[model samples]
Target: MWNRPRFDLKVRLTLRVAAISAACFAAISAYFLVTADRAAHARSDSIAAIVAKSLELQQGKVQWVANPRSDFPNLDPVAAYVMTPGLCLAFRGPGGDMLQRFCSGAPAPANPPPQAFAAFYRSLFDPGREAARPVVVRGTKLGETVVSVDPAVQTAEAWHEAGRLMLALAIALPLLCVLVYAALARALRPTRMIRTGLERIAANDLTTRLPPFDLAELSAIRDVFNHLAQSLDTALAERSELTRKLIALQDEERRHLARELHDEFGQSLAAIRALASSARQTAAQECPSLLSECDGISRTATGMMETLRGALFRLRPPDVEELGLVASLEGLVAGWNGRSRGETRFSIRFDGAFETLPAAVSANLYRIVQEALTNAAKHAGATKVSLELTMRPDEIALAIDDDGRSNEPAAKSGMGLLGMRERVAALRGRLSFEAGPNGGSALRVVIPLEASDRQLLDHAA
Candidate 1:
């Protein structure tokens, strides 16, 4: 059972409104009930006073008689004249004996109140309370005129009044809740857009921004969100520019280093080899015993020259802009194939024209491929490697797959992969290196071209 409490704003607001309204309704009902109780008591007192005054007048007009029943002055007329519904009247002699009594029978209510309500009403008010006034004439005390209001009648009246209020409350509460819910839903609708904008930001799309909102709070959030996105976009743009400059500077430095090595070291090694050759020739002519030592020196110098050439090739690759990206990559694959010497077969597949590519993109793409191939060859020790480059209208994709040992741990921590990642980030591209399900690993890079570059490629295609 999923018993998590609902966190919906609309629902919670609606419920809170309902609770406060119900409390207000209860307060109103209590006030009405209290007012009704006071009114009921006052009406009973008024009836008693009127009946007592009428009795006094009637007795004063007649002669005094002590007859209990026959000379009771026919009190029925006074009772009848002063009687009202829910009212009761009684007269008792000075001896505490009832002489005459009249009650205006309170009619039964059409719809009685509930027992619970009746009990509550009775507990709050004195239902059996009565108003009494003494009847006296000629300085002689007569029986008391007692008047009381019926409890059942009072309860029925209170119930009717309260029932109407309850009915009104019952009808209005749901409508009020519905209105509140709808208003809250409309006010909070902009939250969905905010969530989507945040998601886009998380996905590295700093250009995503929220539109203006009518509510002040939401509008403030929109302003802050747009400002943050703008700041991030600016920051990322600056960072990428810096990274590109750094990469360009790194390449320039490597080229300088390679040039110096080729100039100074190349001349020295050539001189040494020339010296060894000349010494070997003289030794072969004069003393053939020294020929072996001369040959050894020449061989050693030649091996060192081969090592230096390999280092120079890696340090300063061929110019990608002059030869174009496609030819440069083809040459790269051929060199790798030749170096592997059939131990690992390297292949390249190109889908679209690469001649019109921007120089920066061409350079970064070449470096990323170079780093990936180095990892595959040196780290993974793959036997067969395939490189695929596809150019679409909006983006370029390069995938390298090799049937070799998975070097995922090394790929994650190696400087080569780090350099590749930095180059991809500078190009605002995505890079992924993962082990294949069955065997080796696959490295994929996706770089989206700018509008101008895309247009150039389209025209060239």
Candidate 2:
């Protein structure tokens, strides 16, 4: 019966799906960036090797080429064909230094790239883009031609693209999530309506009906929810009617029992007492021992009558039906105070029109207050007990507090509290136990006052 709160369905679904998508996107993006970068590196290396081979075939390049600036310009056609953006073709002298004059299709760097930048870029792309070969033209040796391109620019460009891609994803993920959340909410819109219906049902509105839905699944759910509410309503109505009848029968039975005990056992004891008294008077003149025996019998009869009186009071308080609820509760508390005998101080207060209440209401209130008083006297070890019966315009409130325990009530192990709850619930009332201001326990009960016709209608439905 206890329902703990959980996140909304749309939000939970959106977040879960968004997280999974983000993970998958991240993996795919990394793989794509890596593959694209490797493919670029391989293309650059292939172009460099082609340029070097072309240059080697024409110039007969070998380990050494004398006066390379004057001779290696034959590579202009090869450089024109091979060079692209971020691609640089260079011919290196035998000493392994760039020949800027021979470079074409790209601006030459002012100096050889720093070893550190090359080493880092190589690690990310391809490390072996440098190409060198000996030119053997007609089996004759010539200086070697080396062709190379640095992929650092390509690496920087790849990273820039990656950043742009990440930025796009960052912006789009939320928008996508928002769209998804809206869709989910729309799809589960009936669930929200169903939840509202359930809440109304929880508040005892069995007449609550879910609206028709467009979706078949939602329509089915609505039908089921409506049916369940109807069934519960019917069941609870039957149960309440049964309870009402049982309570009426029980009260009648108690009244009958009380009357029987009072009329039969009460008269028998009274007659025995009168006969014993008369016998004692007659015997006192002739035999004193017989008079003493009559006196003992009279005392025993009086004791039995007293026990029967207590039992009758318990079965049904005599004044409750005669004097009404307020007076009955006051008398009950007065008895409790007397029993406590100054160990616990007691107070009773009533406000508003305390009479004219229905018989069932009066009976339940009386019984519930009786139980509360007995519990306070027998269990609560407080020095001060307070009882209040307040009649508001819409409801009646009863509050009983003691000054014994602090902050918490004693464990409810016995049937007294449970029976009290049942009695209060039978009258369509609310009961609660809380910590009293003075460290004792407070018992509060509220029973709503409905019109007689309305009460009957509710019971019938």
Candidate 3:
């Protein structure tokens, strides 16, 4: 089932205004119609009384006994004064026969109201109600005068009045809706800015802030949004600082551990291998059978030494600051290629100068590449890996693409990707890992340079 479409604030408010206006117009029209009905009834009664009084005056002046039917005063003059559109006057003799009747003989209206409206008005007010007055001359009943207003005439008048009101309403309602919608749109225009600010914040731009607004409610929102942005920016800065320090400490600890292992285990293993070789040489001729045992010991010591060297290389990578970022990365790729021994191909592409890069950025970039390469080798089973580092005026970008099995699951759950994220976060950068175009996966990192870095680059250029 489809859900009902929801209108925005401006449209909803305009629609509500229109509804209220229509209701009010209906009420006003009803009241006007009722008032008109009462007025019409009062006018009919007054006309009846006037017509009765005129008849009595005519009776007193003329001799109804002398010529009862022949000399009855003419009611034409009275009808001229009392008769009007939708009105009629009548007089009946004592025998209940009509003696005189006068009507306005008004024509039917050109644009008559609908039958429904006429029926409804008649039902409410009974517009055909007659006002009757009995005429008694000298205690002898003469006739009765009756006056009535036409139902159609009264209904038509009420409809015309209501039509005027509806005409005005029809003309004004659309204008009213347009004005209301415009006012609401102007009032809520700041919402667009708020939305943009929120989008920036979602994109990890903690510095984004909403400016002060003219409306009190919008200003309050601005205050809250700016305060929240400020808090988030401060928190992020503190977190980045903390992460940088932690990473520095970790590198220091690794260096110390690597140094200790090299000094203690490395020296011991070298000594054992040298002693075994010496024993093998001496026993080659002295005992002949002990030669195999001596050779086995030497081989085992050599294998242990090789394993320790690999561990040491990972624990304490070459100093990025001393070796330079480009050289360090090149050496790292070379080391990986040497280890892969034709199983995988590793390559690097440098686009711009990195001599002025910050030490922290350089070190983190080196470590990120190292961890990415390790994941590609162990988890992704990549056969070909390529690294691209570009130093632009505004930002530094690093992309690592490999042709291998997709490592998305391992990337999500592995510590290698997490470490890469932390390093990127510390530099206020973005990290994205997704499937490569051809096959396997691609990792991308972008770190915008600070104002000072940009200025330095400009000066260098």
Candidate 4:
């Protein structure tokens, strides 16, 4: 719509061109004005000199002719006039009394020109004023002859010449401007295409590209845009993958919880019910077996309570808050080694500031070590295991190694390894699982104690 904002490039170009053209025209006009004024002054001076000389010569002849007794007294001053064989106008003597005057059908002389005729008449012949040459003639003998050459006539011719110059400039300047505009538009053509291409792009149209720009400067920008688009696309893909993984993990957690509740609680309830029914049926007979059954039921209920509490603690350990990480991890290792049946001996080592670690760090590291041991117990098939948990400068490191062949070649779909990866990633730690020196799986993790994160945790604590 006409009311809408427009990005028409031609308008800008036209403004720039008009400014340049106007400057050029101004300079040209100033130069011509100065040159024309100088030329006109020069022409006026030349004519004045010619007229002065003619007057001097004619005066000499008049003096000779007036002296009848002198030689060549009959000679006519007219014969000596150079420009047209006879004077266009003539005057008698130097003092102002014109004894005689002659002209070729021209008007009679006006009284007499002033003494300084050249000075008085200079403005009349000025080029800037009008296109005219006014010539004044005076006699030195009878004091003068004077003539005024009508500049109106001479100026007409000069004006014709000035008109020709103006015409040429008017035509030539516009042609030059057109040529310049064409060249500028051609040079910037690629830029316009690039702008249009950028405007066409949106989130849905990330695949679009700018026209192939060959200019080195422009190509760099094009490459940068392409890289940004590609990076965005890659990041989006990774986020999508992570989202799918998170959903699966949540579902698995729900299933595990459901199973644990059913298997542990359901069996305990059924056993307690059966024990109670037996006690009730024997109570009417007053038998000793009924009392024994009641006692067994009491012990069974106590054991079930203990087992349920243990399972719940495993799901989210309360010991993490009360006993801290060192006590918790030591307890976990002792339990694992006690249960492990194979020749794989588990050893635990620790070094550096265990007690001063932030609670969150302690919790995550404990979980990582627990998971690593569980994995080794279940899958590594090793005979001996070594665990090193240490804190270095600004960092905490955990390593678990076994002495049997590693299962590193397991498929990527294996959730145990995948879960380890996720937990390590969440903690912003590095994780590596590979064959150890003795061909067993060695899992290592390192987490930095970033000062900012430490400060945040300390504040929270």
Candidate 5:
């Protein structure tokens, strides 16, 4: 099933880093932005303060130019007036002509201050600008002079610088993000490798190992995966060994049972048959009632012999180990047909190179077929059965099908089915069961001899 993105550690880390980096970048950039304009304004304020002090020194000494019409931008007199104790007024036109338009109101000026002028006028002189110190004017005192300092140029420069800074940040942030992403991915390379290695391990491929990622932080995780792979390999080896022993034990038990049934039970039934024959022969010389009793005894012994024979056949089957899986399956079909009601039909098919199968594979294929047939007869009200043993170059396939109304419960647990699964697992084979067409069941097993080393080894043995 596909899952949506939820809270994951890696994603959370990435988001946190991005947030912090963006916030920090924004804060620093904003600081520069604000300071850029403020510093410009401060320079303007400093110039204004200087102009105001210069004007205060020129309070009443000069005739104050009374609105000068000449547009000669003169700084010398303006600077000189700043040194005196009187109001001083300075002006410059748009053409950069400085004029001392007014002093502190000796009378109204003949020409008013230029309607459009830009200038810096100061009320006092400071020794730093090398102007005359303010001296006491012997005349009447005048009102304080006002100074104006223009900072249009400085303000524009400040804005331009701030724009450049913002532009640089805009251009660089995405690149920074890209670089950070790459560095983080590189730093986390070992973790990705570990994840991939663990995935392969989960898929039961233990032949591959993760490389040594020497990061001290991740060293423990590396060791854990390596240890896990080693443990899995050991477990798989032990499981294969156990499966081998179990198969061998099962073969031995089958052999023991086959021997016991053939030796003890077959002999006892034979002796009983011989005794019954003798009784029949002896009863002929006796009375008619005795002869009838002998016939009943002989008939009972014959039936007993047949039952014992059938039991032995079930216990041992035919020479499956000697003739291989295909012949054994054919024998099984014949036996089933012989025992089934005359109404039931049976068929068997063999495909591929059946003789090339390994013995263990052959055994598993036969047992699967056996279990399938037994299930069909017991649970499916089958009137016809079909079995197939198909071998390919790479795999061995067995299929048993029946044409009958299924009588097995839909979902109840059954040992017969469980045993089939266990047998397939032990052989490292695969089994599938499906409802057959026309209301019956189909059971199949496909064992890949090349894929299962243990099966191959046992078959070689």
Candidate 6:
């Protein structure tokens, strides 16, 4: 299954900061845009009012021309005094009909769109250049003068302000994010260090510990982590020592029992064999029927001795160190196949160099394979099994697959699989059992030459 991508603390923090900054800048930019447009409109209207009022008498006397000129022309005083860009003078009758108009540089519209007037009311506190005033002379309204704020000029101003704001944000955001991320990463560096140390402890490296930290809170955490690691190391050491003593005692007891069985039991069997032989000879003459019974006793005693010898060998397999793991496993598979029933077949394939492996590794791996085969025979109900032994540059791997239906519940609690796991765990390796390719059970083992790169080692702490 695919999983969604997860953002780390740094990424999440940076994105959140950027969002907040953008929101704040957006609000500020909006306010400035509205305020600037209103200021521009008001200033233009005030200028238009003062210029129009100065020409009050001249506008009142203007009469309609008898013949139209080639183009509408401004008188010298009107042109000289009121001619300006986006500003003009219009003389209108009592009925609000235009009579004559004066242009400073460019003529203003007689009536701008309703949209512009609507925008002015909405920005009532800061309306753009939409101003109208009545030109009155001697209490008679001559015409109405209107000035509209140039939309282009207002747009350019807003653009400049917005551009500056955007530029500032663009430069500041990255720098701010970098500063924040660096500070946070440095502040939390202790946590990462502590986590790494815990993983080491989990991997059985009890010596692992967090480094010293500068901040008081982090320093305290580091100290606690170090103490915890120390406690775990001490506990693991004691447990390891106890386990070693117990294993040594167990091995010694096994060897002693084997020795005693050979010395005492072998002698008793030999004495019995001798007594039986003597009885058979006597029986052969005294009672011929008794001779058969005596011969049976001799044969039974021989078989018992043979079984005892095999048991001893099984308790502690011989030629392990001397014959090495490959030869040992070969011997093991041969024995299993010989003893198996129901058309069962077992095979083993070994590859790569095994000369550099530690004796403990070889021995444990041998036991693991032995246990797996035993499971296959007794529990897996397999008809065929195959083992693959391989070596890669960084690791050694062992795989055993059998064509037998698995009993999963039993497999989990099985001593054989448990023992295999214990051995692999001790070696800091990975071991697993699952459904086989041939609809049976598979045992997989991978032991790294060095410590495996896994975060799971943290659990050791």
Q: Return the TM-score for each candidate structure.
A: 0.68, 0.73, 0.82, 0.40, 0.60, 0.63
Task: Kindly list the per-residue Cα lDDT of model 6 for residues 99-159, writing each as its tens digit.
Answer: 6665444343443335554464345444334566676777876566655544533444556
Candidate 2 residue lDDT tens string, 147-240: 4444655555555566667777898889989999989878887787888998988766688999999999999998999899999888877776
TM-score for candidate 4, residues paired by index: 0.40
lDDT for 363 (candidate 3): 88
Off by over 4 Å in 2: 1-11, 49-73, 80-124, 127-147, 178-209, 212-221, 288-296, 319-322, 339-346, 379-384, 392-394, 403-419, 432-440, 451-461
Error of 3 at 256 (Å): 1.0
Highest lDDT, which number? 3
The sequence of per-residue lDDT tens digits that candidate 3 reaches over residues 58-147 is 888776466556556467878877777878788887787878777776688888998898888778878778888888778876788888
What is candidate 4's lDDT per residue for 273-361, written digit by digit as tens?
A: 67776776677478766666676776777677666655654565545668877788888877667667545578898986566576656
Angstrom error of the Cα, residue 335, model 4: value is 2.0
> Considering lDDT, where higher is better, how would the candidates rank from best to worst?
3, 1, 2, 6, 5, 4
lDDT scores in order = 0.87, 0.72, 0.88, 0.60, 0.61, 0.71
- Quick one: best TM-score, which candidate? 3
Query: Clash number for model 6?
Result: 7
Put down candidate 1 lDDT per residue, 1-461, tens digits, no spaces.
89998677778888999999999999999999889888888877887777778878777655554542335435677676767777778777788776777766777788899999999989988675988888888778887777777788878889999999999999998888889889888988999999999999987778898999998999999999999999999998998999999998999999999999999999999999999999999999999999999999999999999989878888888898899999888988998898888999999999988899999999899999999889898888888899999988889999999988886567556999999988998998889888877689888899989999988888887
Better of 1 and 5 by TM-score: 1
- The lDDT, on a scale of 0 to 1, for candidate 6 is 0.71
Tens digits of per-residue lDDT, candidate 5, 1-461, equal 99987874555666677778778877875587457545544543453356544444444323366854443333454555343322344443334344344433233333333322212111111111211222123443222223332233323333455456667777776677667777777788788788888787765567657777768778888777788899888887677668767766876787788789778877876787788778778777775567777777767878977887776766667766688767787777887888886666778888766665666667766666776777777667678888777766566677877876555773113666776676676665677777776667777787766656435444654
Cα-based lDDT at residue 282, candidate 4: 78
